[model samples]
Structure formats: structure tokens, C-alpha cells
Target: MAEKSGKAFDFKLFRRLISYTNPYRFTFYFVALSAILLSAFAVLRPLLLQKTIDESFIPKDEKLIVFYISLILGVLLLEVIFQFLFIYFANWLGQEVIRDVRVKLFDHMLGFKKQYYDQSAVGRLVTRAVSDIETIASIFSQGLFMIISDLLKMVVILCFMLYYSWQLTLIVLAVLPFIVFATRVFQKKMKTAFEEVRTQVSNLNSFVQERITGMKIVQLFTREEIEYASFKEINEKHKKGWIKTVWYNSIFFPIAEMSSSITIGLIVWYGGLRAAQGDVITLGVVIAFIELSQMLFRPLRQIADKFNTLQMGMVAANRVFAVLDTHSKINDSGKIELQNIQGNIDFEDVLFSYIEGEEVLKGISFSVNAGETVAIVGATGAGKSTIINLLNRFYEINGGIISIDKKRIDTIDLKSLRSHIAVVLQDVFLFADTIFNNITLNDPTITEDQVVKAAREIGIHDFICSLPGGYHYNVKERGVMLSSGQRQLISFLRAYVSNPGILVLDEATSSVDSHSEQLIQDATDKITEGRTSIVIAHRLATIKNADKIIVMDSGKIVEQGNHNELLEVENGYYKNLYDVQFAEVRDV
Candidate 1:
């Protein structure tokens, strides 16, 4: 449902879509040749039939009849060969083009800024990248090429028809105006209908994906019936959208068929009349005219449907190109690549917002010296996570000077800047793969032994060894097979293995039990021992011994000091926050 651009049949867009064939131009030209050959081969059988009937049948010449029949059969055999090559290569080319297109689409998506994803639906994107691209394949296989071949065949048939009898050719030409007009009308109706179907498809995909991903919440709240009702409403719209296309097809096809039948009836009636009037029109000529008429009208009829395929492909291309045309990716124009990064982080007068005019981090200033651990303690929505996001260049800042090792972070190559930092987030997401693959992320450089060593350093090696497949244990989607605490351990192990110069823990131990927290605390101590670390924690007790603790409220830094120094301040923000959390622990 992105804003559509251009017409249903955009020549520029069509030209661009065809440009993907540039990589396989040799194959593309070959496919074009096949189409031309197929069309040329098509008209031969009808011409041979005309010759057979005219020369052999009336004379009762068995030898000539057999010769003509054999020639016709030979033409058919060649037609079949070209037909097979055409179908096979056309489809192969379509698949190759889509393969290249899908890869580029996905690569474009990967570079998009996180804000783009925040505003976009995953399912709609999946539909565009996956299903929508599939539709574009038919544009090459069954749409453009087939239409061209059919038209070529029709043109060749018309030439032979005119050669044999101009009067019958004129009769056939008379029916074309009606067919063309009806086709234009059908084409316009189907274009609109197909656009609606594409929109509904995106909506349906988004709804179903979201509901399935959140199915646990639905069942926990006992909203299955409510969700099902909503799904039915979306699904009903999808059905109605398709039914509109079907309705238009029902109306248009029968009209086309009746017209074709009428054209044949006219050919028979008029040819017989010409013969009776002694105009020298033979029986064979009349039959030839009938065959040519069928050839002409059949493509005319099918062209409308083929046109719909082309239209639908164009619609999908429009949606896809919209994404490729987006300019929301984070600018990575920096040339400086970090070498021997010391991890000296600074945020001077940083200002940011997820939404304009509503600042989340207002002129925030902080610093973390090399190999020092700084803890940020704040209430929910205090812009703690937003700071981390900006430092990583995941979101562009409105106004800020963020630097690492005395160099502007934005001037540091984005990849090199991130390669030195590892973050263990509160919500850890794992793929549907083995634990080892998730940890190493299939990096060939990081072997199983290195993963095990990192896990041991984090004190999770023994726990992993207890699983069915140890390091190879399948964690399923989002690590659903592991408990929340276990997943947090896996995340800690993942971070530890990276050997990052700067480590970030965003409420990493917040959801674990006392036993798991003890293990995580040990891992945190081991990991942050010699690295510059930023810890965002809600629990004051967790960071009681940090070198510096910064307290935030709303969007500004309210207090900063060591635990003892801050507690000494009578009404300090950190002192008050510490008291509240301490009292809660005491109450428990």
C-alpha cells in the first residue's frame, strides 16, 4: 500500500523492468528469436492445408495428397521443437530475472534506516520482496513475449488471407474494431481490479503475520474469537477483490467468444454465396479463410487476458520500485575506518527524537573514558536506549556531536564503528537455527571451539553441554526453546565471543532469576573488565559499584556521581531512585 506512481502501463517503468535483462542479454536475444521463429512456424500448417485441399483433393491424386500431408506433418514437428525451446527458455529467463531483482530488492532493504522499518510492516515487505516479485516473473514468460509471438502469428496469417481472397480478408478486418474496443474496455476494468487485489493482498499478509507472531498474547487474553472475526473481515475483502476480476472476466470472455463464432458464421455464409454467384471462390479457399479467422480471433481473445498479466506485473513492479526509490538509508559517506579503536565515547549536546517536535534526548551530554564502565540509570522512556541507537548510527540525530576516540563517530566508517561494539539487548532475538550458528551467526572465521571457549568464559558452556545437541542444539524461532534467562545467557555468550572494544548491556540481567542473575553478573564482570562499557539498568543495586552512575529524568541528565557520592547528596535524583528500588527489594 505504498503510494503508487505512474500509470497502470508505465512505459518508463516497463523499460526499467526490461533492463534487468541486460545481464542476460544473450539469453534474452535468443528468447526473442525463439518467439519470432514460433510465430513464423505457426502459419505454415494452415497454408499447407489450403494447398492440400486445393491441389490434391479435387484431383483425387493420392501421391500429391500424401506429399502435402507429409509436408504439413514436418512443419508441425519443427513447430513443436521451437515451441518447446520457447516455453522452456522463456520461463528460465523469467526465473533468472526475478532472481536478480529479488536479490537487489533485499539488498536495498538491508541498507534502509531503522526508522524506515519502524514505520513499515514486515509482512507487507515480505509480500513485496517475495510474492510480488514472483508476479513479475510472468511478465517475461507469459506476458510480453507471448503477446508478441501471438501478434506476429496473427499478422502473418492476415498476409496469407489477403493474398488468397481480399473480400474475405476485408470481412475479417470488419470484426476487429469491435474486438479492439471491447479489449480496451476489459483492459481498463481489469487494471483497476488488479490494483485493488494487490492492495488487499498486502493488507491480508500484514494482518495474518502480525496475528500469528502475537498468537501467544491472543490466546493468553482469550481473544481468539475476536482475532478470528478481524481476520475474517480482512479475508472477506481479499475474496471480494479477486471476485471483481473474476466478474469482469465472466462478462468479457463470453462476448469475445460470441463475436468469434459470428465471424466464422459470416465467413461460411459469404464464401458459399460467392461460389454460387460464380465469383470463382473455391471450397478450399473458404476453408482456408475459416482457419485464418480462428487464428486471428484466438490471439485477439487471449491478448486481453495476457494484458491483465502484464498489468498485474506492472503494479507489482511499481510497489517494488517504490522501495528501491526510497532514500531513507543512513548516510555512510564517511571514509575513516577505525584502527586500534580505544573506545573513548563522548556525546556532547546530543539532541534527538523519534518524532519531530517531541524530543526524546534533549542536549544530552555524557562521556565514557577508555576501559571505563559507565552506568545509565533512568525510568522507562528516559531516552537511555535512544542514546545507544544514535551512537551506533542506527538513527540519525537532529543535532549532536558524538565522537569515539576523539574523532566524530559519523566520520568513522559505519561498519568499522559498529564492528568494535557489541550489544546485549533486553529482548534477545535468535533465528530458527542451532545455538552455535546463532552465536557465531555462521561466520566461517569463528569456529565451534572458539564458540565453546566464549561460552565457558561466560559460564554457559556447561549449561549448553547439557542440551540435546550441546552447541548444535536448535533454539527454534526467536530462541523460543530456551527460557528467557537461558536466552539472556546465550546473548551474553554471543557478546563475549565478539571480543568487542566497547560493550553495551541494555537491561541484560533484568528478566533473569537470582540464580541466572548471579551467572550474568559473573559474565558481565568478565566481559566489561577491560572494555569501555555502557550499562542501562533499572535496578540500582546492579550497578552500585560502577565507576560513574548517570541519572536521567525525562530527556536530560539530572544527576551524576559514584554511588556513595550520589547517596551523600540529600535530595539527589540518583539518591531518591536508589531509595525507591532499595525499599522495593526490602518489601519483597
Candidate 2:
């Protein structure tokens, strides 16, 4: 999470963000040049208006009047052209920069270890990747370049005002210090307000996402009203955040308008007195000073608003950079390629923990030879699932050497190693796409024919065809359209299509019905035949045919043997566990 800074502008962060625009350097430079040209043309219009009044109208020269009018029109036309270029190029640069930043942010997230996600909310990450990045785009499109253009126009206008009458210019600028002081106060207050708004937006997104995802639980527990009340509170906070920004704007803009009016009044009063004295000031000069004063003070007011946009963008950049700067990436230093891996897995004195000082796998040693089936049975929280996680290197181990085919696992390339391993977890996840896509996961090489063949081999082809559209059916989000048993079968088909050398089934059959269980068992036998398999068994009968059974208690292996051999022990943990946990299944 990013903390809000009290500084009005984070120049260091601004510089870092500007570096991303290097790729579109040409467009950025063009926009900057357009701003300069716009200022020049804008200032020319007022000077032309002053001259037309003083030289052409007073002397009543029609031809001169026509020439001055044409020149003023040309300046206006040039200003319009430059304005168009500025808007187009600035927006183009913003879009290009944000596209690159979004890709970089997503790629960085992909490299983060599972522990990072374990403690983070998915909605918060989504907000940073989507909404916050959009806010940063305003920095270029509406904030930075616009601020520069306004400032340049003000400077040019001030120079012209002084050229006309230094005394009148001083009179016009008397109230400017008060306006600048007010603007500083507005910037500081609005920065804090914008930060609060962003935080509230993230909280609102997280709350809504979680509630929708867990709607089943909420309904089952009859928590609709309670959840709605909580949401109302969050929504109220979000509303309040925006209202704070509105309140500040309301207070500051009125003050700015009052200051502008007062400056114009002071100039008119003093200039009128000077003209009355002895033609020291002209009528045209007084009118031009009014125009110049508006140009100067107007941007001061707008600069406050644009500065708010820039401040919000900086806050978003800070949050995004915080995610990029995280050092919790898993080490992928392995250079070895395990082509045609034999699937001989060995865990030597492995010690692990998901949290500090709370060891989950304590000095555990185990091995599964090539083409062997190993079943691990344990009570809940006996670290059965932890083994699967460690095998796939999802979490780093504290102390251990896990090897494949007598080669250290860490020495193998991360992608290549995971390519040869398949895991079918108890809670299977499927995308909201076609069944064919769910099975093949849109792998270009794995064609529709290949997926159908894999499904048929696993005896799920007929079951799939029974559904409307067969493989083309949309499963909706998270495969909600499918039953629990059907989803498990789809997961099996997905694993089988991959043809992995090592297969891990972590309670894969624990949540299915009897018919789905039969389908899964048939698929399991076919897929695990020629590969090394590790089964985290919940039901003892599921592992009765295994080559070896390892019973675990409190992160340590208590017994290791085949079913009959283990049952022969008088008071063995497996024997007692079987009687207590699986005797009813056996009778049924």
C-alpha cells in the first residue's frame, strides 16, 4: 500500500514517471512546441486589438482598419491551429505512456511470489492496474501541458502589460499576491483530499468485489441486509471524499473571481485619474490592461485546478511504483533444461513455513521413484497440501534440497520445470470461456481435436457432448454453469491434455459425487499410469491401490507402507484413522 506524502509535488516521482514518455519523445516535444506557439499567437491577439483601437479607429482610416482586422484574424487562426496540435499530441503521448506502464505493472505482478498475493486483496491490485493508471494519463493530457501553456501565456501577457504602462501594470498586480497565497493553500488542502478519494475508491472496489465473489456464502448465512449496510457505509465514504474536493473548489474559485474583479477595478480607477491629469494614459491602453490582467489572473485560478490533477496523478504513480519496487520475487536462477525429465522427485530434510516461526513441514524427507504412485494421508492441517505447494515452488522452503532426476530442482529453468508438472487442486478454477478453451487453455498447439481426444480418453467426451454446444459451451465466470463434479472432470481433462511427467492430485476427488468420482477415478488411472503421481488423499479407500502410503501427523511422517501392511499394525495411526474416518465409506 502507498502512503500519502504531505509534499505538494513529488518532483522525484514526477521525473521517474516522465521517463516513460521517452518512447514517445517526438510527440511530447511537438506538444511542448505547440504550447509555446499557442502562447505567442495568444499574446499577439490582444496587442493587435489595442493597435486597431488606437491607430485605425481614432484616425478613421478604413484601409488601415481592414489591414489590422486581417492581421488579428490571422493570429486567431494560428492560435486555433496550435491549440489543435497541443490537444492531439498531448493525448496521444498520454495514451502511449499509460499502455506501456499497464503492461509493465502486470508483468511485475506475474513475477510476485504467492506469499505476496496471500496477504493482498485482488480488488486492490485491480484498482491500481486499471483505475489508478487512467488517472495518471490526465497528468499529460489535462494537467502538465495545460499548466505549461497557461503559465507561458501569463508570462507573455505580463510583459505586454508592462510595455504599455508600468504604473498601470503595477496597479493591476496589486491583488496578485493575495491570489497566489490563496492558490498555495488550495493546492495543499486538495492534495490531501485527492489522496483520501483514491483510498476510498480502492476500499469501495475491494468491498464490492469480495461481496460479489462470496455471494453464495452471504446468501446461505442470510447476510444480505448486513452486507448492504456495510456497503452503504463504504459508499458514503466515497461520496464524502469527492464532496471534500468540491467544497475546496467552491471556496477557492469564488475568492479567485473576487480578486480578478478587484484588480480590474483598481486599474480602471488609477488609469482614469492619470488620463484626466494630461493624456498620460490612452483609452486603448486601459482596455488592453484589463484584458492582460484577466489572462494573468485566470490561469492562476486554473493552475490550482490543474495542479490538483497533477497531484492525483502523482499519488497514483507513487502507489504503482510501490508495487514495482517489491522485492518478494521468487529466485529463478536455474539455467538447466530438464528435457524428457524422468520424474524422480526427492525431498531431503525439507523444512518450510508459510509464516515466520511457524514451521509447517518440519524436517520432512520423502522420495517418489520414476513411474511410482505415492499417497499421503493426514488429518487436516497436517501439511499435506503444503507438500504440493513446495513441489511446484509456489513458496520458498526454509531448509531443504528438492531434486528431480538426481538434479537439483532450483538448477532447472522455472518455466521448463513447471511445464513437466501438472497439479489438480481440490478447488478447481476455470475461465469464463468455451469448454474447449477451458480444456486447452487456448494453447495454440493444443488444437480442438487434441482436447476432444483427451476428453474421450478420460471418458468425459460423452458427458461433455450431453451439454448444449458441447465443447463450445460457455462456462461463465469461474465455471459457475457447471456442477462441482463436472468442474473436477474438466480439470482432469485439462491436466491430461498437458501430458506432464509428474502429476499431483491434492484431494482432487474429495468434493465430487459418486458418479463423478467414478469418472475421475477412471481418468486418474489412465493419466497416472506412466507418470510419477503424488496423491494427497482425504478418503483412505482412494489410496488403497497405491504402491506406497505415507501417513503424516503434525508435519512429520508417522508411518510408510502399503494398505494391508499398514493395517496389520495393532495401534498404528493409519489403522486408527481408517477406522475412525473411512469405515463408513467402506461399508457403503
Candidate 3:
């Protein structure tokens, strides 16, 4: 990861980000007001010191001293009250900002074309939304709090120092240029370290996540030792990243503290001798200057700390913007609107390629009327799945047209077009929620009764009912809590629940055993009764009842016929596949 240019820290991103909390304006205003009020105490409490020394003590008046002391206590009490308010609001804003960013990020991720997911890793996307956003929020909340308050306090102290003595003010302020120069250097080094930390940490997260996800496979292949050693190396790199961050911070804080202390000691010594030389400055004034000197650099120290935090936050903000800035290569023009879909689909001379000059679907042409079922069968990478993807507009066709009911898909608003399609894949992914939720994920507004009904129609209701919590039973990662057959059944239920005009079942029943497969076949036959359906599978039996069987080879349809007709073609690929299946069955 590259450290952002100095110009990248401009307020544009921050201004845009603050708009996320536009709905919560009152919260923001009150927090800002409270911070300002709390910061005013820096000037007020120190003025009390000046008054006690220059007036109350000079007159030897105990009552006046008591009065000034009481006023200082009151300012302290008010400061504490506003400080509480400031803390509360900043904390609330940080959480809300993080929540808003995550919500928007997830929504955009879903809208992204399939190609994005194919290129991006789940762990990296998660880190962007969770870890990166959280780090930025911390800077906004706690770090920003320290920065604003410290700067305000320093300004007030500087003004008082100038008013009391310009000569002293000039002497004391000379050290500021050195501090600022040092801070700029620290920020530059820390930024580089911060970038290293980000890249290493994310790399570590990706590696660990992948290892965990494939841990069972590793054990099956006896690769545990290799995986463990690789993990240790990545972990060490992450540790080194942190070490660099700590090294910069360690040098920064002590240098800041020692410099401030040395400046204060110099002030006391020089001011002491000046007073002895019978200058117009009083003993009381000298004491007040001493007190003010200590308070002066307190805020400066805070500013120094915030500089490091700001660098880290800036690094995170750049990463987040890079994600939010991504736009899909294909998106609808918002002109096409379909109130209803008849599911008449056509692919007119369609050509597609995920990579340049390597067409996956070469001039594919097909049409299916409403309520017709089409089967696409081919060897692996023969472009059977690619054809379905183009039909659903998951990928923009490199050449030619795809339309539904005579309306071109690209012209139709994507949301309207996609709403009419339901897809069930072999690789099932159920949320870590109840079975009812997983089935009705497409239509969350559906009632529990409707969910159960859909499940029954799909032939999975009875089995689900037998589970410990019925439809409410939890489905863990990839629905590992349920059997493979059960997961497939739930996927079938999900597709059916949408009542889509067109259904795509891609190797949907591959996981089920023979008995459950028979059940699912019966259920799908009923489900696709009046819908345009496309089935892609290696198993010939699954698509036996399809209205049209499309046999593809080398990215082109080589044959098209019904089961009996295809079997009659002695030289056809479908005939060869059927012959192989029968020969294997007879041998077994």
C-alpha cells in the first residue's frame, strides 16, 4: 500500500463522510458545542491563577484568595460536565459513522457485478468495511477530541502570555518552529510505517482466513505443517509492522515531553533573573508566568500525539475511498422499466469473453418461450454457465444482444430485469440464520407460513420440521449444520419463494443422495410448470424432461433436440454421454 500524497488529506472525503450523519444533525451540533465550552476552561482556570497572584496575594487578603480559588473550582466542575458531553457525543458519532459506512459498503458490494467478487477476496473486503473503517472512526472520535481541545487550550495560553509580557512570549514561542519541523518529520516517517502496518495486517488476515476456510482440506492432504510454518511467517511480518509503528511513537512522545519540560525550566530560570534585575514585571507576575508555562505545552503534547493518529486515519480513509470509488463496467441506464415479465428470453448472436481474445461464449444464439424449460449440457469450461450468466446480465456480452419479452436487457433497468430471475447453484450459501430466513432471503417480507409452505412444496418441509428447531433452526457457515441434501433443498426453496418468471438451476441437485434427488426432481418439476427455466448440469437424467436439450462443445452449441431425438442421433455427443452412463451402470 502506498502512503497517500499530502494533498490527499484534503477535507473533501471528510465532508462527504460527514454527510452520512446528516440525519443526526442535532447529535453533531451538541457534541461540537460541548467541546468548545469545555476547552474554554484552559483560559479561565489560569486567569484565576493570575488574579490570585497579581491582586489577592499582593493585598494579603485571604477572603479574595478564597473567592478566586472557589471560582477556579466552579470552572473545573463546568469543564468536567461539558467534557462528559463531548465524550458521549464523539463516541456515538464514531459508532454511527462506522455503521453507515459498513451498511453502504455491503449494499454496493451486492450491487457489484459477479466479476468483482471473482477478483476480490472475502477477507480483504471484510477488512475494508470492519477493521479499516473502525480505525478511521477511532481517529475521528478520541484522537480528534484530543486535537481540538489541545489546540484551543494552547491558543488561549499563548494569548495570555503575550498580553502579560511580549518579550517572554517571543522567547517562549521561538521553540514552536522547531517543534513543528520535528512534527512534520515524525508524520512523514509514521505515515510510511502506518502504510506498512495496513498492508501487512491485511495480508495476514487474508492468509489466516484462507487457511481456516481450507483447514479440513489441509488436514486431508497432510499439509498442516506447511500451512503452520507459512502462518508463522505472515504473523511475524505483521508483528514487524506493529514494531515500526511503536518505534516512531516511542521516539515522538518522549521528545515532545522532554522538549516541553526543558522550555518550562528555561522560562522559570530566565524569568527569575529578570525579576531580580528590578524589571517592571512583579514577583506575582513571575509566579503566574511559571504556572502558565507548564500549561502551555500540555496541549502541544496532545497535538503531537494526535499527529500520529491522524496519519493512520488518513491511510484508512484512502483505502475506503478507493473501494467506494469503484464502479462496475456494466450498469443499466435507468430507462428500462418492466412492470411484468413473460420470460420470453432470446440470445441473438451473443458473444462474451472475461479475458481479451478468449471468447467463452462464441456467437451463442437461442430463444425460449414462457413456461419452456431449456437444458444446457457440456464438458467443463464449455461455456454452459457463461451463457446463463449473460442471459441474467451478470456479464455484459462482448457482442450481440440479450432480451426478455422483446425488450433488450441492457436497456431495461437492472433491478427490474433481475427481479424476475431466480438462481440456484450447487455451491449453496445460507446465512447463519434460521432456515425460514434462508429460504425467504429474497423476500424477507414473506410470513413464516409462506416460508413453510414454500419449503413443503419443495419437499424439504417435513425434513426441516423434524429438525431441533424446525424452520427456526440455525444454519452455520455454508449451512454446515445441515446435511448437503438439506442445504440443496433449502436453496430450492429460496429460488421458488421468489416466484420468479425465469429460474436457473445450475447443478442444483448435485449434492443430494438418490432418494432426496428424486424428491427434489419432483418438487422442481412442479415449481417450473409455468416458468421459463434453464438447467445446466453434467447429469443427463436431471434434464431428461427439459423441452429443449442444448449440447455445447468448445463454446458453441453443437446439437439441439429432445431426449428421444438426441438419443436417436447415433453420432451426437449427447448420445455418446448417454451410452457411457448406461455402460457404467451395467458394469456396476
Candidate 4:
């Protein structure tokens, strides 16, 4: 979209990107100095060539010839040194700036609300943080500064050419319009091509990542061929986007090279004619003009290429900045920090909707006293999980107040609020790490002893010790090395060790095997002993002993009572749910 805009150069975006170099001012200034010196050095070589021909070789003085040769070699050596410094420091600056930007981008992403992630693709975010920032780095290393240096070199060469012979310079200028016109057209086309390339790259990344992550489903459902077909289509689009840029390049560079050759040819013919007619155009000037033509036109060719690099970087910056500009993060404006939170939670007529006018939880009201264990039961899509999400402030409620210990959750410091609660979801996620690290989450305050003590209390210590490395046994990604029951145990251990005042188990044992159900139930009873716990479950048997059971359907609570009390009520929501589940268990 930015590429479609008439303005090829976005000055505001360019300035914002340049601001990242503020911390590396010394390296930036050094690279700038190298550019100016390299430009000056480029002009000196051509002038020295003119002097060498006229003042040394023409006079037939061997001393002057050797002296001028030594000076030329010295200039060349200095030029090489400065050229290396320019490239090295320019790249160093680019790398350093991108490092800072990537860190900032990741940090910004971490603070975003759950709603943000719900609407975004993981691979697209990965591309922005990784590849897109890498493109921005090129803006410094090969794009902006390289364009500046090349332009400066061309200007210096032009100055030297005009001073030598204005007539010869005019002849060189005759072919300039064609190259400039071609370069402008090439840059514009390349800008759009680069934008398409980036978009396709993002799509390819997202497609591949989703497919790979869900590979088991693909194979299980025999959808591999279908998925591969989808991938081929996406991959083809990516290839086409890149090929368009190459097509433009294949057309533009030859035009630049031809224009340079034509200019050089005209200069030689005109200068030679003037010399034969006894005009002021000397042989030395003619020789110098030939070298200067190359010096001038080579940069012109390179600037066009480097300008595309600049354009691509600008496009990347625009996308990266768009993410940084997003206001989707949970507002952590609450200054209140609760110490030793009692975990008394209340949801007062709360309303929420993932989409506007389609409320998921409508007029939901609930209360849990300190140190109480309440079970929330419902059919699927009954806004059961939405309650847990709301409690954590993962999404702002559409209406009403959620509070802990009588203080509004919105008025409590987010970190402090979450610190007092630990949630163990049904679909457990574990890092590819040892059980010890997963339990402690690498928290320095939560030592191995603390984890072991908690595990023993929860009756899972024996199970952990039975493993090859005990607490040190690696679970691999998502605990794939372990079974569904084992991962649930690990999740329980993780929640317990945190010593949270409030614990939420969102269908923690829903997927566990029958053999592991007793261990899970025992572990659950042990952990919920004194803590204020909220258990969401589909099985009626698991929550029968709960002090309170809240039954929900659709988007509202239909019943609230203990198991026996709800069963006593005829045609009750909880009574019907219990009868159906109990019948299913009996049938099993």
C-alpha cells in the first residue's frame, strides 16, 4: 500500500529510522567521514593521472614520473583503507541498530493483550521481528549511507571534469537524461515489486509455520497432499514476486551501462577533433576525462540499485512501525499493588464480546470468598474459559467490574495481580527443557527444594523421581515425550510451586487416561486444600465434592448450588447435566 502511494520516499519514516542510530553516534560520524574522504580520494586519482601524463611523462623527466607514481600508490592505499572502514563501520551501525529495534519490538509484543494474539498470526509477528528488522538494517549498511557516498563521489568527479574542459563536459552531459529517466522508472517499479515480495514472504512463513505445527493433524486426517498443494500455490506467488524485481533489474542495468559507454564515446571523439584543430583540449585532459566518465557513471548505476534498497527498507520500517504503533496492549494504568492477596474474586454483571454485538458472556455475575474452591460447569461455548481470561485481565471486559479483595482488578497493578494467581490450562504447554526448569520456570526465587517440597505435598514426587533424570528429565516441546496425563501433572506442579493464592484449572484432567484420573484427582485435592481455586470441568464426578458449583449455558449462568442441592431441584440445569454425565459414566 505504501508502494502504491505517489511519494517514493517517505521522509518522516526515514527520519524515524535514522533516530535509532543516536546511541552509535561515534560509529555513524566515522562512517560519514569515510564517505567524504573516499569521494575526495576518488577525484584526486583522476587529477593525479592528468599530472602524471603531462608534467611527468610528457616532459620525459624520470624523477617526476617516479615521484608522481609514488604519490598515486599512496593515495590508492589510503583509499583502500578508508573504503574498508566505511563498509565495516556502516555495517556495524546497522547491526547494532537492528539489535536494539528487535529487542524493543519483542518487548512491545510481550505486553500486548491476549486479544491481540487472538487476531494475529504467530509467523507474521516472527517475520516482523526477525526478517523485517533485518531489511531495516540494510537501510543503514547498503541503502541510505551508500547512496549518499555514491552521490558525493559523482559530484566530485563532475566538478573535476568541468574544471578540465567545459566543452568536453558538455559532450559527456548529452547522454545523462536517458540514464536519469531510466533510473527513476526502475526505482518506482522496484518499490512496488519489493513490497509484494515482502507480503508474499510473510504469507509463505505463516502458511509453512501453521502446517508444520499442525503436521500431526495433517497426517492423521490424510490431508498432507491437500496442504502441500496449498503450499505450492503460496510458494509460487513468492517466486513470482521476486522474479518481477529481477525482471526490472534485467532491463535497467543494461540501459545504465549503455548510457555510460555512449557518454565516454562522445567525449573521446569531440576532444580528439578539438586537439587536431589546435584547440585547448590536451591529450592528458582526454585521458583524465575517460577515467572521470567511469567514476561519474558507475555511481549513477549503483545509486539506482542502492535507492531500491532504501525503498525496501522504508517499506519494512513502515510495517514494523505499524506494529509498534498498535494500541492493543492491556492498559496497565493501575497503581495499586496488593501484598499477600486473599484471592477473594468477584465478577459483577460483567459483559464481553470477542466481536461487536456478539456477546460471549452477557451480564455474568459471580463471587468467590477467600480460600474457597468453586467449580464452574457448562457445555462447550458457555463462556466458561472467558471467565478465566477476564480474571487475568487478558482481555478488558465490555462492562462491569472484576475485583480481588474488594479492589477493582483494573485498579490493581497488572504484575501484582497476575503474580498472585497461577493457571493450569487443559492444553498444557511446556518448553523444550528439563522438568526442573519447567517446574521452576527458571525462576531464581523458586529453587529445586521448593519445587520438590511442593511436588511431594501434591503426591507427584514419586512419579517425577521414577523418570530417568527425575526432575531433570527433558520433556521436549509441549511435553511430547510425556503423555497427556504426565503433562497435566507437570502443569499442576508448576502452578503449586508458584505458591499462588488463587489457582485456576481449566479442564486440567479432561484429557487424562482413566488410569491417571485417580492420581490427578488426588493431586487436585491436595493443591486446592487451602488456596482459593476455580475449577472448570465437563465431568460431573470431579466437582461433586466442591463447596459450590456454578452451571452455565450459552452466555449466562443457569444455576448455582452444591451437587446434592442442584440434584434435588427438578428439571434443573445442573440436575440434567449431572444425570447425563453420570449415565455416560455408567454406560462406559
The lDDT ranking, best first, is 2, 4, 1, 3
Q: Rate the local accuracy (lDDT) of all candidates.
A: 0.90, 0.90, 0.81, 0.90
Better of 1 and 4 by TM-score: 1
Identify the runs in model 2 with alpha carbons over 4 angstroms from their true place: 1-4, 276-278, 586-588
For each candidate in turn, give its C-alpha RMSD to the true structure in angstroms.
Answer: 1.3, 1.4, 2.5, 1.5
Look at candidate 2 and give me any clashing residue pairs.
none
For candidate 3, list the clashing residue pairs, or say none: none
TM-score of 4: 0.98
What would the per-residue lDDT of candidate 2 be over residues 37-120, giving only the tens digit for each residue? 888887787788888888889788899999999999988888888888899889889889999999999999998899999999
**TM-score to native of every candidate shown:** 0.98, 0.98, 0.93, 0.98
**lDDT for 350 (candidate 1):** 94
Candidate 4 local accuracy as lDDT?
0.90
Give each model's clash number. Answer: 0, 0, 0, 0
